[model samples]
Target: MTRPRLLPVPLAPLPNELIGSYLNRLADANRLPIRRIDALIATGRHHSRDKDDLTGWTLSSIERLAALTGRNSPALIHALPSLAALAQPNPLPTPPASLTPTAWKTKVCQLCAASRGVHGLAVQRTYPHQRICLQHQRWLGGRQLPISPRFHELIRANIRHRRLLRGHRDPLQPSALHDEARTMTSRWFSNNNGPLELQRTWDDRLQMLNPDTESDPHDDRNLIEMVTYPETVVLTTLLSKPHNPVHHDFLAEVIRSFGLDPRSLPALHRHTTLPSSMRNPDTPSHPSRHRPGSKSTA
Candidate 1:
């Protein structure tokens, strides 16, 4: 006896969607339990605990899914970023030891998903640089914020961050730079005695994002990160360049551009270090070579 061909469903997978999510959507569309659909498509033991799990999936399983969905394997691969890794003979490359994965995994923007006929929740394996949906102007991985002019700066910063990521050969370099920038920005934001102008700017942003009388903006780390993103991008760019003494005027100008007093430079200098590539090679032994805060002594 031979197995029969499965009927194709009308629903299609969204970009970067998990294979499990697509299967669930298919089951929902056809009014069948996901287990039935899984039994039909997945030859290996299915794990239901983690929705993102593709542990036992082979190339044949992906091909089965593609056939069941009336789509080609390439189409499925294009839609599911992790499918290629699963289909390949080799395991996925391990991320750099220095880089830790974020605890948060973002869902596809509700509006973006609905636009593609995907009404069910669809989780995505997003990169560190991917925080906002530029097309829909929605923040991912957290409660959605209302569209406002205040978020425009964040959107612009994200654009620059993406561009930076593209130009770098080692993604870890950009990731490290972003991490450092986030640390500086977060620290400065938490400093009550920091520049009053900068503090007021962030406070206004907090109010804009959280208008409810009882909502404490300080409690929402996502909101704080979003509001501080512009400065972070700017600082990342500054730190990537060589620490030129002649750049102090330019640095102060950039600080002033953020509505911060140039004298507040120490707040940015406090804990930040210059990247090795950005350090002065002639004065390798100089204390300021490692720490940007010691520039005055240099």
Candidate 2:
């Protein structure tokens, strides 16, 4: 029986690393063809991800590679971000069978791909709901790509958005708030008198924020920019809160800021109550006249 050769570098896998990336790195560092590395761990000649044998890897192959790399199987597997979800009690749903790897690039975080020591693109950090890279405080718009000119305003709001996720432990809030933010911005831009000029101004400002987008003016304006805006997120957060006597006027005030009459928003009235209905001895001068949590008339 032939003894398996040990890796020259014996690099330990990083957290959230992809199995494919690890194999590629091992092959690159050892000056070996990637296909040879693939053959060493492959259970058969089956190719996944279209002729990428690494994608069709099996557990026995992982164990074999772990030994070759001088790392434990469990540790190696734990470091695989793509497989991490499978370990959960409720694993993520499998992707559609017809979808190809090329169709899935936008799902991953761009900044993580640009990280040092990464061999190539890693698929482990792909969470489509995640529009912001909290680690880099940048936007992840494309495959392993980060948008430029990181907007301090949007970054600050994204921190609060993450806070809401952590503070409440609600997985749904991020997407819900994100959706509402886009809706608010779309509504604002939809019925405006100077839509073209306003859109041009917004596009120009957005270009300043992400200079790469300026090179391609024909590209559709990224909605994530609107969704991550501080004002948009602030309103979305406030709207997500439970309706109370304290919030009715506050919500109405925010609605009015978009140049629309508060009275036109019946849904807002339904979700919030008038302050007058629950006013105490410490109540302010008027119900619809003050912002929430404030002790003054509007």
Top-TM-score candidate index:
1
Total residue pair clashes for candidate 1: 0
List, residue by residue over 29-88, the lDDT tens digit for candidate 1: 889787877777765665342266667777777777776777888888888877777766
Off by over 4 Å in 2: 1-4, 45-57, 85-123, 128-136, 143-150, 172-201, 210-298
TM-score of every candidate relative to the true structure: 0.75, 0.56
What is the model-wide C-alpha lDDT for candidate 2? 0.53
lDDT for position 155 in model 2 = 66
After best superposition, candidate 1 residue 66: deviation in angstroms?
A: 1.8
In model 2, the Cα lDDT at residue 198 comes to 36
